[model samples]
Target: MSWHPQYRSSKFRHVYGKAASKEKCYDCVPITRSVHDNQFCAVNPHFIAVVTECAGGGAFLVIPIHQTGKLDPHYPKICGHKGNVLDIKWNPFNDFVIASCSEDATVKVWDIPKHLLTRNITTAKKELLGHVRRVGLIEWHPTANNILFSSGYDYKIMVWNLDSNEPVISKPVKILDAHKDVVLSMSFNTDGSLLATACKDRKIRLIDPRSGEVLQEASYKSHRVNKVLFLGNVKKLFSTGTSRWNNRQIALWDQNDLSVPLLEEDLDGSSGLLFPFYDSDTCMLYVVGKGDGNIRYYEISSEKPYLNYLMEYRSHLPQKGIGVMPKRGLEVSACEIFRFYKLIPTKSLIEPISMIVPRRSESYQEDIYPLTTGAQPALTAQEWLNGVNKGPLLVSLRPDSRKQLKVEKKLPKKENMCLSNGFDVFECPPPKTENELLQMFYRQQEEIRRLRELVNQRDVQIKQLELKLRNLCMNTGSY
Candidate 1:
């Protein structure tokens, strides 16, 4: 007789989800009514930005993370897009910077003020115009600073370098034009060396962003992938889609070989699209479906039966969209390893759900809270564009480490106010006199001019390097 183990013993087996109280949630939010299947909210340790409905143009509200509860009806917004906003993402390196794409076929990068907002912001720090159709997806490079990727209905992906001090970038550094249909989802590998994408053409592609070359492609008649995610630290790719019989399904594939999936499992008969989020530190994957109230999580392993079902977090109110907080934003003292901000449009509220590992002791759990990707970038934009690949900087989540982070985030005494608990809690003092306000405006103008001059110099150097490279290729007959 053959013996087989039915269940695996693990510490995370008892992990459960807990929702925040009503007063802790954000209420009375005018969530966008657009039917796009994208997450309508973007969050970081500092702020929560949600796409809202507007009459004349597109706009999104940026609320301070700590200011939870009911919001005023006329709260300030960041309104500039001439069309409906499709997606928004916070820069991984800089919490004060964010990028948004819209049906206007433009991508705009905005810099939130160091202090809380008082009026609507109608200007963007930088505007990128490249796509000929409505842009739907935007993602920042995981390890590089000032690098962003965006895809649109044109079936092309544009890689932009925001490092340039220029106010507008008319041309992108590189373009990946391999997809024949709209790209559904994109994920980058651990070192940011490769990109995996799922498209509406029923194909999965692995591409080298540096050279605009497709490294590998796979398609299965049984699966129609809607979302793709890279399992960092593990050389595998996971995707969620639908099976031929209209059942939701998930599959795991080896990063190197895409001929066949390592495992494929059918979920249910739900028609809504599934969004997958992975936590590399805990090796946990959360799958949330659109128009559903349940969040299913699983543990991933490199051994046999690679994907193990952990449990599900069920709720009565369905989520219109969801935002995930970075690992640094989690509360280590409470044994919280992950958090989800669910957008409940029906109630006009955003609720916080904390995923905690059951523990009785008050001390920190070092085993569960391992070193995670920090808020620092590993490389600069120019280095990444020049064929450099690096992983994100890792930081310890110990209480002492968090205190040090808080100290580093301190602002100048003259411009500082205080928050009771949040890491970034500094306020800028209002200008007392008209003379002081004038002086501040002139200083900003001067800084902008200086940056423009620096950008011009950098552009000249880049052009010189391109000329030299072309000449070298011509001499070697490789052009």
Candidate 2:
């Protein structure tokens, strides 16, 4: 039987010190990796990024979705950071830009390659640095591409403009002393106007990104808000983490008035910390940490949340361990696990047979028109109708050199339309799991070798029996 991954647990006590639990944890460890709770999104389904503590001090792991289960020595290494990589976030608009914060007290923006960045960004591309202490958080502006924010133990937050030659030479557009202690976490409101910050001081502060104004501040005097989860609605936020201050409480807060939580609930009898991949869509959150390695799920809703307790499951990781990752599907716990497992490279893994990168066509234009059904809206109505008969796309350069906007307009009345047999690039062959395929090939070779050895042994035995029968016949004739 194949070993399962479900048996992995935090400690002997985590399985309630039962023999059955120990066996279960053992069955699951080899195949399973850690997972976070999210109503939607598979666990590490597709690794956008990874922050790890490895032999080299710290490492950033990037998994190219196209390279799924293959193991290669070189993947993506943005380089430049001098210490352990602590966090990573993909540029919300341009999936091309990735931001990673490090213990080196710097947050560097990397250009994620569609295929691979054979060259590290630091070798030739400019590097951006601003914080004086270990950077703790790096968040992209919810609304714009050029804007992003960084915070660290420096007791200050700095914002950056990715477009400039001097990313940080430009004074931080805004600065705020967000907390009395190290700012453990910071996040912006969904609209990009407000920023919520959590700190070692047990206080959560909301700031105006444009003006660096602290509009409201609240203290979980009963406990500390280790992380502040902002509801896009702006006036409200949900928080989870250790209650060094509520016995580790989970609370909902109205940022408009941060004096008191709208609602608060103590964790189950067990002391646990709130750490998870929070989902804005469903308003549910995952909490993990403290004494247990299991993840807890909760739904937060309300001017103040009532903190309805949800399901909990074991996520194997070291104590005081930490992880927060993307959620792209409903309970993608396994997906997350797959990506996590891919982070730690193994010996003798199969390397993917990759295709050569395609170069842009010689005739490719910098301002290529978009493909729409029927016509280019930029053309006159009659021209649009004519273009519809020709094809669905029209390339235009007349608008402006800098802003060549190519708009798509739908064709009307398909009464005489004829379908075209254009080939589909999307119909590429389905992929095979690199690991599973390699195992099958290895097993087949072993089976063939074993069969040949068995055949040789049978031949020798038959020869011995014939010789013995001949000896018996000779002895009878002598008698």
Candidate 3:
């Protein structure tokens, strides 16, 4: 074959990372100082949520995606957790819903308002209290709605089905007690049929989430695995950890047979933990170290030499954490294959880095932009819990196709739904006659008058309290 090619010739071989301008980045964010290896940031198309440092309780700031640049110091936050917030994940199916786990040994689900937040939200839509110790990890089921998995310091994994309207789930649907030590990381297979966990005990276990059974377990003597991920399409498991020599290493394994890795590569002897993020559509793997300013990426294939090094993107500021935007949220116009929100703790900034595939054509690149997982769930929580297995719904990335999908998503159904905390937004028929309109106006006027009276009463009470405080201070000679 003409002496065989020295390197693989692929369209993504020249992919490059582009950091967004300072004007487009989020600044002055008080990122959390927790020593946990969790990503401190989570992003969706609608908003970017970042865990922040707070007193008394844990809090996270939710900023509208379009409202970039310097954030307000007094911006509203979700501050319901009694302990430090460890991890937060947005529901794959619902953009307005998010679940957060904290050191308080509880997991809370919050319903975010569609509009910008104007006040602190101290209450969660639902609270889960099954963990006996601090919860470190929480993940939403990939293809199912209302299914959540949490791993705590108690070395137990709890699966919750949030199909019902209950505000609290004190009991989980299933509890997996396989790990003897703290769980370091977890990942679910393609249809979410199998769960893989890397634990502090130096073992990786494949578990059946529905039945709470351990399907497979393997531990390499030379590797201390810290993070794990499933290459859904390739039927492979990937991990990052340290070798016996304390050098960082990455391993790839067959999901069914983890006795030996298909490939193992040793990286530098950096102390920072490597966080691995893989894009199923593009077959790309991005490895970002916690305290490093460079992102090394590779192309994963099913053939020999499973991991092929592509390129590395370097920066001056190291990233404390990172959040990945979904494939659907990428800019197809810019040929952006992936986007990452890099959290810079020293500068208190969140920067968006877009990985672009340079193509001259302005037209949509159909080969690169394949039909990816859409914003719909393939199975309901009940269906999944009942042993149903299905892949995620896929949608096109073409402009016209995306517009059509958006239109279809906006079409309202017949059922009137109520969110948590009895928050209801009802669609009512308009007044049919002038008399009805007049009656509605009169009712509103009466309510306004009553509110004004309540305000006046509160004002008088405040004045009386001020007078009493002044007199008391004078009596004590403290004024």
Measured against the true structure, the TM-scores of the candidates, in listed sequence, are 0.84, 0.57, 0.84
- The per-residue C-alpha lDDT of model 1 at residue 443 equals 40
Cα lDDT tens digits, model 3, 1-479, are: 36755868899999999999999899998999998999988998777999998899999998987688899999999999999999999998777889999999999999988767999999999999999999999999999999999999999999998886899889999999998999999999889999999999999999999998999998899989999999999999999999999999999999989998888889999999999999999999999989988899999999888899999999989999999998876778789999999999999999999999999987889999888998789999999999999998998878566346645667464344444544432432355555345434544554475569679989999999999999999999999
Rank candidates, TM-score, best first: 3, 1, 2
The whole-model lDDT of each prediction reads 0.89, 0.49, 0.89
lDDT of candidate 2 at residue 311, scale 0 to 100: 51
Candidate 2: global Cα-lDDT? 0.49
Candidate 2 lDDT by residue in tens digits, 326-424: 322111211111011112112221111111112334332222222211111222223322222121222332213212321123333344332354432
Candidate 3 residue 35 C-alpha distance from true site, Å: 0.7
Q: Where is model 1 more than 4 Å wrong at Cα?
A: 1-6, 402-479
- Worst 10-residue lDDT window for candidate 2 reads 329-338
Candidate 2 vs candidate 3: the lDDT winner is 3
Which pairs, if any, clash in model 3? Answer: none
| Model 2 misplacement above 4 A | 1-47, 53-58, 66-70, 73-76, 117-121, 124-126, 166-170, 244-246, 268-273, 303-305, 315-410, 413-479
